[model samples]
Target: MLIDILTQRCNAQRLMIAEAYQSMYGRDLIGDLKEKLSDHFKDVMVGLMYSPPSYDAHELWHAMKGAGTEENCLIDILASRTNAEIFQMQEAYCLQYGSNLQEDIYSETSGHFRDTLMNLVQNIYKGKPVLILQGIREEGYTDPAMAAQDAMVLWEACQRKTGEHKTMLQMILCNKSYQQLWLVFQEFQNISGQDIVDAINECYDGYFQELLVAIVLCVRDKPAYFAYRLYSAIHDFGFHNKTVIRILIARSEIDLMNIRKRYKERYGKSLFHDIKNFASGHYEKALLAICAGDAEDY
Candidate 1:
């Protein structure tokens, strides 16, 4: 019943349910579920209780909390989200934690990688919503000249003096629309004869390059990139339950079907199959439920 309710309801509906549950019982749904349930099942249920932005902000806090940072969590969220989404997540972060998300990120991270994340998340701080939110999708205007120019700038960053590389790359990646960025990536390949991901791998190391690679992969094919992330999360012969739960829940409404298709294409097996093989019990059942309605194996 829990699985059915969470899996069947839209996020808004689920939030209503959580609210109703709280009002009726005088207890928080997530808190009760945490007390009753254990392990990943609790995680899935609790995650379902929050709205998407709250959940994202929650993930971000956890990513930056404690002894060390989970750089992948930061990269996965900040790199892939649209500017509008980031803005909402930032607001939610502030509301939930009573601290500025950007400041926390700045204090937690350092150097070029920190700078890149700040750039990606800077739109909200500027007191204006980005163009993407104001219906850029229906128009999606891509300028080839601009793309080529941006491509040259990126090439210079890779080939030229070391000091300016991060600025050049993050400026374009953080600001461009996905359509324009795609064109820029094509121009980059034409000028450099190397994939941008490959170039980043060559030119930078540590989390700086990792963030760039994630952005490039996300720009080119988000579902494919997510599929790879899902694979990477579980295929290490160890259960990365946090990453798997995060991706499955976060992308459930957004693009799970497309991600499922890409996963099969890339791995020669269904995501359902992989989950069954790699995870078990109600934890697996919860994942499979969000992933329900389509599990046809290739």
Candidate 2:
């Protein structure tokens, strides 16, 4: 019943429904649902109630709230979002929590990896304006000479001291445009006889390494990056519900249609099949609703 109603209503419709329920019953709709729903299914229902930015803000709060940080959540949200989206999340975080998102993240994390996430959320990098390729339609402009120089820089960075390398990778990965990075990636391979992903794997460890790899993959193919995340959540970690929920719900109206195709191509099975197999009951139904498109396995 909950699945049927939510699956049928868009966010606006859901809000209207909430208002009608409140007026008719003289009780808060969300509060009632919260009291009733449990586990990941509850999370899905509640998440469906918030706007995307609001939901993201809530996730970041919870991620940073406990003693330890959910670094993957930070990386996934901060690194993958556009400058505009980050700004929106920043505002939402402030409005929802009455706290600065950067300060929250700052207190929770430290060192080079923290700085990279800061640059992303704070847009704090000074000097020359970095082209934001996350949401804009590229003019398809890329400088071959500049890419070669940057590629050489990365190769050289790999040889330098650890501090120097972290600084270099942070600058290149965070500031450069997508097309620029794509060219630099190819050049890096040609000059070094190794993939950039492999280079990061060789040089770095911890959250820093993971974030850099995620950035490279996102630049290469955002949907495919997400598809791989889904695969890991579903298979490698035994239906990591929060990760699955975040990706599917957040990307549903964005690039999920493409992500579905990429998942099938990469995994030799449909995302729907995997979700159906791994997740159960209303939880599976909710995820499938977000994932719904084609019925056939690829």
lDDT (Cα atoms) of all candidates against the true structure: 0.85, 0.83
Residue pairs in clash, model 1: none
Candidate 1 local lDDT, 1-298, one digit each (tens):
8888887898999989888988998988888888999888899988887888999999999999867999999999988887668878988999999989989999999998999898887754246555444311212668999999999999999886376766888878877788898999999999989988888898888998899899889988999999999999989738788898999889998998999999989899898888899878888888888888562551
Which candidate leads the pack in TM-score? Answer: 1
Q: Which stretches of candidate 1 lie over 4 Å from their true place?
A: 124-141, 293-295
Query: Model 1, residue 258: displacement in angstroms?
Result: 0.3
* Model 1 alpha-carbon miss at residue 62, Å: 0.8
Give the Å shift of residue 211 in candidate 1: 0.6
lDDT of predicted model 1: 0.85
